[model samples]
Target: MPTTEPGRRRRPRASTVIVGALLTVGALVTAFPFLWMLFASVKPRGESVAYPPHLIPSEPTFEFFAQLFNELDFGRYLVNTLAIVAICMLGLLLMAAAGYGFAKFTFPGRDALFFLVLATMMIPGQVTMIPSFLIINGLNLTNTLIGISLPMLVSGFAVFLFRQFMATIPTEVLEAARMDGAGEWRIFFSIVLPMSGPILAVQVVLTFIAGWNSFLWPLIIANDQKLYTLSVGVSLLNQQIATNPSLQMAASTLMVVPILIVFVVFQRYVVQGFTLSGLK
Candidate 1:
């Protein structure tokens, strides 16, 4: 009998290649305007708007950015935005943790109370905006970081996400912890939270991005330029763009960079959080 020739197996391939390629293209397209904004921010004044514009500046300069800082109070805006983002993130983490507890643990009217909280998510932010502003104004929080962070503190979406993830934790683990005399708070803080690392990371990134990009509320509530967030500051710069497009782009550049850095760093955690939360 003739020895049979060994068969060659076709190279294995995953559809991820095609999916990734398409996603890459989509991401590039989505990112093009931002790339242009960065390029425009650094390009010489006239070049930013040259007919048939330049994607890659012939020569880039930071002069516009310098102008932005010198002429506009960009630094104050930067501080304000950073402060609000930090405060809001801290508050959101705590609120989400509490919401996770409400969903996973039993207590009198727990289900009813959680349902009431969930119902708030159905109400549009716009509907609550005016009332929230009035409350903040009444409390002398207008033009304050606390005002900006307060309405955003208890995020309904964050609560819902945390609750979903926490529900996936095994009851056996909680029972074991309880057998060892772990209180509800102890079990949640020690056992439940450690397992929730991925969701918390996701919430942090999401809440930071949302807080960082918050425009309308900041614009409405912040009357003093000293208290203006990047979004409001950039809008204020827009009114004078006819005289200074370069400066405006430079301000826009500032407004966008922090969020970009954040997304790049925490993107993996965000994806993992979505995966875990979606499971149940």
Candidate 2:
């Protein structure tokens, strides 16, 4: 058996303790706003902003929630957001598959085309915003869910992540599948896709979150109040907060809860994707 120095063992133990403390602090900082929002949302309308700012309400009430549902068009906003996210996810999946094919397979001008696509990511989104709006307007999609989802349907980030992941797949596996008379689509769907569990999970979580939180594009395209996304809806709630603080908190609380749930469920995949992508 190899003998370990006491000093070396202590170094690792000390490192572990430091990491744990940092993580605990980080978690508390991130969670504080969410905790505050939840507590505030349940408090009585006037008490939510009472002097001294109670962390926990002495008397909790659902009046805010009831007001939000009855007076605000929150339900319509939620449905619009859900529809746009669903469409964006479907389109992003297709784009990811195309990027994977281009990265992992051979074709004429594939590298040139992908590089061209990648080059566009270097351009600021603001620069293209007007042109994109014009195109959507020409298509008569503005003020619709399709318009809200259009800008996000094909993401350069998603393509980049998918391509990087697919590049790591073994060439031998692809060749073997080809020799077994598997078609290109079949190989992608059956063999390569089955082996891409980690990347797919990462893509799904990232894309879903992006679609869920998208604000600017949706704001520009969805001129109708009925088509507002969660972020835009929350911003509108901020406008009403002065008069209906409790209801505003309830709306904000509602907007954040779904995102929190998604993060908790897919945090592992989110971490893995970020780590792996960073390495590349």
Candidate 3:
């Protein structure tokens, strides 16, 4: 009998090719503005505004960035941003503990209480701003980092995400720990938290991004020029020097870089966290 010829290599399906092409186009479109900013920040002022909008710097310079840091007092703003972001991280830990309590512990009116927590999320931040401002001011926290950070400490969304994720922990684990004479706090801090790495990373990235982008609360609360976060500072800068593309682009880059780094560092865990938590 004649030997059978080897099968020819299979080609990618037309649907796969089309889907990949569409996705590539979508990614380019999404990234175009960021790529533009990164380029424009380094470009000569005239070149930043030239026809066709340069995506690559012809004569890269750090002049605008220098102005931002040296002349514009952005160093103080940066320090303020970092300090607030750090406090937000601390708030996340507290939220995680609360989430653990909600997830594992049985209590009276548990569902109703949790519902109330979720209800708070429905109220827009704008509506609450005036009240929050008054309360902070009454407490003598206005124009202080503490006042700016009070709103960052905990959120209904954080609790919900943590509770959802923590629910996946087995009841047997907690019971066994209790049988071994471990305290509730010990079980939570040691076992539950260590096991919650993915969701923690997810929440961390979310919280940091939110804190970094927080403009309204900080703007209203922080009357002191020393306490301006990047968003508030850059916005004011925009008002004063709206004509300078390079400075604006540099400020935009400053606002975005931290968020990008954070997401990149935690990107893998984010999807995993959502999947484990049964979130869509």
Candidate 4:
């Protein structure tokens, strides 16, 4: 048995050092574009495309942001985007309920039904896009925000996530609630939903990001400028300001900030949900 001297630290293995070095390099490489975007957003339009491509802006200005707000209907787009997100979140609750039913209840053909839902995930979105559009059109919902949000309300992935997470919940707990004279709705709303915080957070973050970044469907469904989401509106902005890199970067920054804030706020729950999901 070898004994280390008091106060002497063992040297780290060469493999550990190499791995640490690689991770540091990888982190820097991943962060470089975002850092460049941040710096570029503050730079003057001409300097943004300078030959040297300075990392730090020589002259920082908020003119690009001001121009973005003043020259565009960004406020209306933001509101539209928020409304879509809210509607999609409501749809997620329905998915959660469906998942809970699949997880907790015994019914004939339940497994077959769930299999069908999972199978939908394998089909390409493009395959159904035309059919979905025609249905929305038939309902006279085209050019409306509700039409844009219609398809996003229930996602197969979200239902699967909820089912996987809810399956881990002990049946005994639900039985106890039933023995206490609690109704199924009462137990689900008061007990199961409250206990589903981590998974719910995961769904919220995923749904919000998906709704926020959705472009193709929104573009197809909404020809009205007032119903345009940030994603579609930003693309229009990009085409108009193609020559002004600073303005483009500013718009990009605005688009990214909300996602960053949402992730930061709920990141802990995401990790916890991922861990729990792996167990089930």
Candidate 3's TM-score reads 0.94
Give the distance in Å from residue 119's predicted Cα in candidate 1 to where it truly belongs. Answer: 1.5
lDDT for 145 (candidate 2): 85
Per-residue accuracy of model 2 over 54-86 as CA lDDT, tens digit each: 878889998887776677777787788788879
Query: Local distance difference test, per candidate?
Result: 0.82, 0.80, 0.90, 0.90
Supply candidate 2's per-residue lDDT for 273. 66
Candidate number that wins on TM-score, 1 or 2: 2
Instruction: For model 4, name the residue pairs that clash.
Output: none
| Residue 226 local lDDT, model 1 | 88
Q: After superposition, how far is residue 228 of candidate 4 from its true place, in Å?
A: 0.9
Can you give the lDDT of residue 210 in candidate 2?
81
Clashing pairs in 3: none
In candidate 2 the C-alpha lDDT for residue 217 amounts to 87
Q: How many clashing pairs in candidate 1?
A: 0
**Predicted structure 4, TM vs. truth:** 0.93
TM values, all candidates = 0.86, 0.87, 0.94, 0.93
The digit string of per-residue lDDT tens for model 4 on 99-192 reads 9999999999999999999999999987999999999999999999889999999989889889989999999999999999999999999998
Instruction: Report RMSD (Å) for each prediction in the order shown.
Output: 3.6, 3.6, 2.4, 1.8
